[model samples]
Target: MSLGAKVAAGETRFTVRSPHAAAVDVCLFDGTAETRLPMTRDGNDWTLAVPGDLSGTHYGYRASGDWAPERGRWFDPAKLLVDPYAIELDRRFAYDPRLSEYGADTADLVPRAVVQGALPVVPPAPPRFARGGLIYELNVRAFTMLHPDIPAAQRGTVAALAHPSVIAHLQKLHVSAVELMPITAWIDERHLPPLGLTNAWGYNPVAPMALDPRLCPGGVAELRETVAALHAAGIGVLLDLVLNHTGESDVHGPVLSLRGLDNAAYAHEPNGALINDTGCGNTLNFGHPAVRALALETLRHFVRHCGVDGFRFDLAPVLARGPGFDPAAPFFAELAADPRLADRVLIAEPWDIGPGGYQLGQFPANWLEWNDRFRDDVRRFWRGDVGVGLLATRLAGSADLFGPDCRSVNFLAAHDGFTLADCVAYEHRHNHANGEDNRDGHGENFSWNHGCEGPSHDPRVNAARAEDLRAMLGTLFASTGTVMLTAGDEFGRTQHGNNNAYCQDNAAFWLDWAGRDTALEDHVAALSAARAARRAEFAQFPQGGEWLAPSGAAMTVADWEDPASDGFDYHVGGARHFRIRRAERSAAI
Candidate 1:
């Protein structure tokens, strides 16, 4: 709130935070020409006032100081840095070797932060989404790029989500909330540009608050209008945010934004080596007050301006890590105390590549977690590698993992891995196209090929795969607690067994509406209706339920422990019954 360009009266004031810089300059751009204005230093902040209203002005920052990377002080005036508080940009970031060069001028390569005028803030209201409802996770660009009804000009943009056909499909699935993948401004990784590939997923973010111009040409207004449309259709929106690391990357990485302004914003060891808790080069230091402030401001900005319901944090453990993961971190306390974010739905991915990072079911009581245990255990159960006991535990909300309350967001597949269709059609990962020699993505997927690998022309193998998908969907719908279905999974979308398809921005990752399985989609709709009808029962674990065998006899411990046990009937107080049979590969709810 104290930083960034703000217009008051007839003059515009610009403020930035760079405690390590000896001096800072605000670079104002008029066409191709630039004029640098020196800012007054006061403690950790720099301020400058310009004459007249500069609301539509494009500007950047250049901090002058030592270029010592070993001591964590990287202040290079040659590399023009973006504002950490920028909500809009003149263009999207592009990868350039000059960005990391010490003396090479980067003014021509970096994106300029556009000074925005006042924005309309949505009135405070309770989130339209609730617990125990379905969350449909989707990639905005990929999800709409292949849709037939959306206009060609609107495809692959945030405005496409507001299309009537898209809303109709969401309404048909009874989606409680649509969890959109990152729409924030991001840059391609250093390696991708050389390899002729790009980071299709927007996980590698730079400006935390800025919207990517490529995905959102209309800026904040585009997002605000889309949110209003989804809300009007009774579907909430949740953004998947990446606050753990920036696209600036590691020691040899680019000198952009925070790294150029104050390298201390990143976590460093005693010897000044960057701490890579996120496996994404460098991790943000949550211990720093500035980092926490930026994060809080970002959350409030989205909630106030765009009217988003909540956020799903990617690599969430970094948010709670100061140097070590702590349950009582100040960030958590601050988020709870802030009135703006207290009521928003918080979901955590719950793990990272850091020390002691696997904190599943350890988040705050009010937060929901993506339960990988549910995903793996369900996959193993259908693959016949595990018995019904493990499946039953996941179905009953995994009380063993989260105690009595159910905060698990049960999901079989997500954007990062193989789709539900691929889970039954591939025994091994087929990611040779990723250019990593099949070394990327998870090795053990707990998948099966049903007597045929990849796509098959045999009708019997296709039938088996379809049956397995229906059974899994039935299990997810019948399970307790909130559930999530990745976009296009309801209609059998496939990434061709590419578990790590973050770079396949082409036809490989886009949803094929023309070739979608309509029968499977109809089955999902029916399952959603059934869950909605019994919403009360699915909200929590069923009480006084009897587990019976297929022959109408009570299930015993031996039956549950038997790996050959194919199916069982669950009767909840005789009001509702769920039948699952593996022999026929069918589930009746």
Candidate 2:
């Protein structure tokens, strides 16, 4: 059954799926007044149809059944539950202890699904993503938060991204796609408000289908319009999604939506303890048929209604965890078979903190994965490590890891870790402002501070840092797979050494366009133009292309094993490297 409130000719239908609930009713709210309509049940689905137009109605569900957390079945009728398939929300959800308590009726404290008319029918054009192109990853809010050209009212919002100034920056760099960090409806972690912080990354999603009001107040239509604007400018959009876990935290966490309606939707141990595979309290049970259906529907809604070009799944191993990580998981098969999504770009973070979690290069051939091996090897090479041969392999493409059939998404820095500037400025993470006494971020950053730990006024130290930064960016663009650059890295943005700045929704996370390193910016642009011409060269080569040495001779095992080698070059038959090469200077531009 199609879930959520759908309106048609003079009739409106409501449907919900919960296998364990004994009884269910749809709750309609108009200020302090409420109307409860009992729904007819057929197996796992509860549905009802009314004969009048119910287009802007605020609605939720109330299920009556047992409340036993020890056995993982908590169904409290008093707690109003938001529909999982809702396309619109009346407002953003605010946290309250009473909303999850056993006997309290908290109807007024939750967000309701709006009974929307029909979704627009603007089909997406053929995907703009090709074999090898640049991907610029950015947060919708932080990217333009400090831009002076955008209107004051539009700053830190989705509407600001569609501004001509923002699009022009992307066009100047020849960006093939803009991968926006998670924009789905999410909540701050339970401990952040008291610490005077909020979740800036939007990774902890509450509603997979609904966009966060703080990010996009104009709702789905606003996002659709933004997508259209980017498409007209010849740039594609990719959404980072959190499908591994919900904002409803641990056992002591709140029962906002999924936990309130059906605890069975989440993964559990044989003893009924919530499986914490995501390291984010609880994980979704992809083995369940209903849970799988919910994930599928969420993907389809974004494609059919939002017109997105692709998705990057956070903690992707959780989706394929059947006893352990399996490349042939049901979800992977479904994605390959779906005509609407097969051609669209699909990327995976490729690892989690669960058992057998580090399954890099193990995903199906159809999906592109984040190559952490590439990240580490590139960092070590520029940091003056001794393994030049290893760096050569990564630069050519991690053929040893992904095999010849699969492609990799090569990136040196992302949102979770330090920015590219911080990678060269701090040897260790500095996260004391997170209120955790600098104990929250990763311990091993694989960075080098050149001379000093933080900012240095010494000209020699600053000069050395700038050269290393150029070399890192140069190596990334000179590779063979798709490349992603953090939004502020082009101008050398820094988080002041805070590697895990997820909780800092302040200036530390926002991109400051006012002060930028213009020289580094130009060098990045030059590298991008060089990469654009190189991508067409690589694409012309057939699968299993011929490999050769820099002297245009055949490559050998010993040639690949030479540890003293600095760099090697190969041609894709007739394809050639551009003449605009990096110089051995502090200021390469």
Candidate 3:
């Protein structure tokens, strides 16, 4: 809240926090000209004030101090560093070798943060998304890139989401909230540009608050308007945020914002090497008060200014790690105590590639977690690798994982893995296009090819795949607790086995609206309607139920454990019944 350019009555105040810097300067840009104003140091903060409201003015910062990378100090005044609290940018970040060069002047390379005036704050309201509703996860750009109804100019931006066609599609599926993948500004990995690839997923963020100009050129107002429109249509908006790391990356990486202003913002080993908890070069030091403050302000900014219902944190374990992940971390306690964030829907992608990072069900009782176990076990079940017992356990809310409360967000597939359609059509990942020698995505996907790999022209193979797709969708809807369906999955979108399509910004990743499988979509719509009609039963684990065999008799222990057993009928409270037959590849409620 105390950082970045703030415009108030009759004047504008520029503030930045750089604890290790000897001095800091506010660089103002005007077309082809520039002016640098010295800021007075106040403790760890640098402050400057200019007469008149400087709203819409472009600005950046330069901090001068020790330039020791090995010792965790990277102070470079030549680099035009972005404001850590930047709310908007005039351009998108582009990766360049000069950005990482110590003495290179990057004023022409880095984006300038635009000074914003006072924004209209949305009135506080309870989130539209409920704990047990459907969350439709999507990549904003890829989701609408090929939509026929959206105007060409708006196809790949946030404003496109407000289109009538998009809303109608979401309504058809009974989506409670649309979990938009990262819309914040991000930079491509250093290795990507040369390979003619970009970060299609905005996970490699530098400025936490700034919205990417390419994605939302209208900035805060654009997002606020889209949120209002979705809310009007009975859908909530949940932003997927990456606060764990920045694109600044390792010591060999660039000196953008935090890295240039205050290297101490990143977690470092005792000997001064940067910690790689996020597998993204650097891990933010949440233990630092400044880092925590920036995170809280970022969340509040979205809720207060943009009216977003909640957030789903990427690599969430890093937020709890003060060197090691702690369920009782201060960040959790602080988040709960904050009046603005306390009641918001908080979901965690509860794992990272760090030490002791797999803390699946260890989040706060009030929080929900992404259940990869459900994803894997359910796939294994339909593939005939697991018996009915495992599938039943997942359908019953994975009490073994989440205890009695069932705080699981059960999903069949998400944006990071194979699509629901691809799961039935490809047994192996095809990620050669990622330039990683096909070793990028998960090798073992718990998938099957139905006697053929990739696309098969055989009618029988296609029929089998379609049936399996419906079976998985049925199982997801029948499972207890919250459920999420990745966009394009409900209608059979495929990436041709490219499980890791983060770098594929081409048509391969775009949803083919014209070619969608309507029959499968209709089946999903029916599944949604059925779940909604019995919302109470699906919202929680059944207190009492009858597990019946296909012959209309009670299921015995032998039936549950038998590998050959493939189907069961569950009757809940003598009112709601679920029928699932793996042999027939059919499930109905």
Candidate 4:
């Protein structure tokens, strides 16, 4: 039987895989009335079929069995369990510990799943982007929260992206693809409400398939319409999905969906404690066939129902961590063989906090990886600590780390770190507002404050910072692989030195639409155009490139060893060449 509630042949059927449940019931709601129907079990799956169409019906699951936290068997019948494959949700999940307690009933506070019709099928279209294209990553909410031109009602929703102002800005940036942060439904951290904070980055997901009602009030149809609008404008959409873990934190966390249905779906130790590989309470159990099937089902849902162009997997290494990291994992092979995801893009974060987790360049050939090496090395070069030789390697595509067939996704800063402007103005992380006593965020940012911390009014200081920003942008564009720019980095967006602004969703994380450096914005646009044209030219002439001295001779080892060496040329065969040079504390493209 297929998972989730599906309608077919004038009847509605509810099927769920509960491997260890002794009893399962489907709780159907009609207005204020509630009806509980017993489910028939065969092996591990439970099935319940009704005689009429349940198109507008809402329902949930109740699995009853032994409750042994230490043994990892959490079966709370009082708690209404959500279907892992629910396409539509009636309300957001409200957190209450009683829902997970062994004998407490919290039906009124739980969220209900709505039965949806089959997804509409559309003719397949060619991908709008390929490797070596620029990707602009932005959160759907923060990107338009303060936009002056967007309508008041649609300001921070998915529909805002289709506005003329938003589309025009993306067009001007010349970005080939737009990577949106997670739009799926998520829960706040267990301790957040008490501390007066909320999950803004959407990394703590609870439901992988249902759209967050707050972000998309218009539901899945709105998302489909938005995708169509972007495709019409020649832009592709990539969603940042969280499949490695769920919002169900440690054993003390709420019993929302997965845990109540089957605790075995999560990774566990020999003692049956949850595995903390993802640093997020529970790591998914890819070792189980049913867990892997759920992941595949979610991927196909987004591609076939929502029509997204690609996916950026968060904490991706967890998917292949079968005892240890394996390149030929079952899920990877399953994805490669699936015809539904043939032309869709697939990118990975490439690392986690678990042992043997940093598997950079170890993914399958079809996947692109986030190059932390490129990000750190480039930052160090611009900070004046590293020399041009290191920059040369990164600019040429970090061949030391990646195979020739795998493309690198280079970036300087992303949502988790300080903004581009903050990178040059803050040497220390100022995360006092995050309520962790300044103990949160990364300690080693490889940043420089240029003789001052935070903001400054000195003309010489401002001028120096401005020039360094341009040089770094120029270097990124001149590099040979795909590049990604944060939402407001082009015009010097700042977060006041908060490196980890994931919890600071206010002005610190939102983009300032009105206050932009027009000059810097124009410079970014020009660099993007140059990169596209240069990439095309390099494809035709793949060889005959070498390092050259500033004096027009082949560079020697002694030249590279010189501490004061500020510039060198990457001379292509024939008369073509590219240069990154610094003179008098200012670099030029």
Candidate 1 wrong stretches, greater than 4 Å: none
Summing lDDT over every window of 10 consecutive residues in candidate 3, give the lowest-scoring window.
571-580
Better of 2 and 3 by lDDT: 3
TM-score of 1: 0.99
What would the per-residue lDDT of candidate 2 be over residues 1-589, giving only the tens digit for each residue? 7888889878899998877888989988887688999998977889999888898888999888889989787789888888988877877776677766788877877788888888896675667777578889998888878888999899888878899999999998999999999888887787887888888889888779988877888888899999989989999989999999998888877777888777888888888888898989999988777777888888878888888889899999999986478888898888778878888888999999889999889888778889888888888767656455686567666888876653788889999788899998999999988889998888877899977999999999999888888888877886777888989899999999999989888775688898889888888999898778667643322344445555566667776676544444444544544111223422111
Query: What tens digits encode model 4's per-residue C-alpha lDDT throughout 469-495?
Result: 888787777777788998999999999
Worst 10 residues of 2 by lDDT: 580-589
All-Cα superposition RMSD per candidate = 1.0, 2.6, 0.9, 1.7
Please report, in order, the local distance difference test score of every candidate based on alpha carbons. 0.92, 0.81, 0.93, 0.83
lDDT of 3 at 298: 96
- Which has the higher TM-score value, candidate number 2 or candidate number 3? 3
- Write out the backbone clash pairs for model 2: none
lDDT of 3 by residue, 312-348 (tens): 9999999999989999988899999999899999999
Ordered list by lDDT, greatest first: 3, 1, 4, 2
In angstroms, give how far residue 61 of model 2 lies from its true place. 1.1
TM, every model:
0.99, 0.94, 0.99, 0.97
> Looking at candidate 3, what is the lDDT of residue 289?
84
Q: Higher lDDT: candidate 1 or 4?
A: 1
The per-prediction tally of clashing pairs is 0, 0, 0, 0
Off by over 4 Å in 2: 538-564, 568-589
**Which RMSD does model 1 reach against the true structure?**
1.0
